[model samples]
Every structure is written in C-alpha cells, then in structure tokens.
Target: MDEAVKFHFVVDGNDFTSAGQASVQIKKNLRQLGIAPEIIRKVSIAMYEGEINMVIHAGGGEADVLIYENRIEIILTDNGPGIANIDLAMQEGFSTAPDNIRSLGFGAGMGLPNMKRYTDAMQIDSTFGKGTRISMTVNL
Candidate 1:
C-alpha cells in the first residue's frame, strides 16, 4: 500500500458488552487486507486488551489502527483516572478492578501484560488523574 490505512473507533465505557467491538472489526479489516493470520491475531489481542482497559478503567476512549506495509499499529487513548503506577500495573496478577468487575471475569490484571506480550512494541503514557495513551505495533 502506498499510504497507511487507518481505522478509528470509540469505545463506550458504560457498556461492558460492547467493549471488544473495535478489535473484532479490526481483525476483519486486516483479514480483508490479506494480513497474515498470526499478525492479525496479535493485533486483535493487543487491541482488545487495550479496549477492555479503556472501558474498565478509563470512562471511555478512542482506539486507532494504522495499517502499513511493514507493521500495524494500535493506539488507545483514555481520559479516565490514569494509572498511578505503571510498573505495578504491568505486573501479572496485580489489579485494582472492583470485585464486581472480577465477578464478570473481565479484569485479571493480564491486560497490559498480554498487550505487551502480543505486540512487537508497546509504549504507555499515563498521568495520574488525567489520562493514558498506549501504542502498540505488530510487525508483518
């Protein structure tokens, strides 16, 4: 492709049922673009995790996907209470999700870790009480 293809989505914070819509759509779009299944899988997983995080923590957010020749990038931005300790947040099995959220089997503290594990590169920018932005890339 001469130019990167971009897709944007707005995640609804109040609706847990609709959290993963963006990632599902992205997976379909990537498949139509002839992206490899593995790459698509990685991108979808990372994007989904980010989306869920936005819904669970941030009151809602925006997700953007850029499809380039060599890589696919997913950017998630949220304006909720930002992560206070990114280091602790990244640790496995560490979560601040409410007991109600846990009852729904949503927050397992694996979102950030899984996002990083699935993507070739990941970066997180967060400000306490402000917001957070996460960018992840998967190589084709």
Candidate 2:
C-alpha cells in the first residue's frame, strides 16, 4: 500500500451479542487486503480482545485501524471507568469485571495481556474516572 488505509468502528456496549462485530469485520478487511495470514491472525486476536474489554468495562468505545505499508495500527478508546492500575491489570489472571460479566464468560482479565502478546507494540493511556485509549501496532 502506498498510502495508509483507515477503518473506524463504534462499539456498542449495551449489546453483548454485537461485541465482536468490529473485530470480525477487521479480520475480513485484512484478508481482503491480502494481508499475510499470520499478521491477520495477530491483528484479529488483538482487536477482538480490545473490543471485548471495551464492551465489558467501557460501556462503549471507538476503534480505529490504520493499515500502512510496513505496519498496522489499532487504536481503542473508551469513556468508561478507566483502569486503576496498569501494571496490575497487565497481569495474566487479574480482572475487575463484575460478577454478572464474569458469569457471562466475557471477562477473564486476559484482554490487555493478550493484546500485547499479539501486537508488536502496545501503549495504554488511562485516567481512573475519565477513560482510556490503547494504541497497538503490528509490523508487516
């Protein structure tokens, strides 16, 4: 690609049924763009984890994917309760999701860690009461 291509999505927090739609769409888009299978898989997994986290905690959020010649960038932003502790939240099994969300099999606290694992780089900016924005990149 000579120029960056961008895709934007608005996540719906009220509906668990629609939680993964964005990630699915992204996967399709990446595939259609002829992205490598490994890169597409990484992007899909990372995006899905971020999308689910937005639904379970952020009430709703915005996701943007920018496809560049050498890398792809995924940015997720939400206006819900921000993460209280970045270091703690990055742990494998720690979660702050409510009992109801946990009962629904959505929140296991692996979201951030998994996102990081699948991406080349990940950055998180959060305010306790305000919101959070996570930027992740996957090199091509």
Model 2: lowest-lDDT 10 consecutive positions: 101-110
What TM-score number comes out for model 1?
A: 0.97
| C-alpha lDDT of candidate 1 relative to the true structure | 0.93
State the C-alpha lDDT per candidate.
Answer: 0.93, 0.94
Q: Could you say which candidate leads in lDDT?
A: 2
lDDT of 2 by residue, 9-55 (tens): 99999997788899999999999999999999999999999988999
Quote each prediction's TM-score: 0.97, 0.96
lDDT of model 2, residue 44? 90
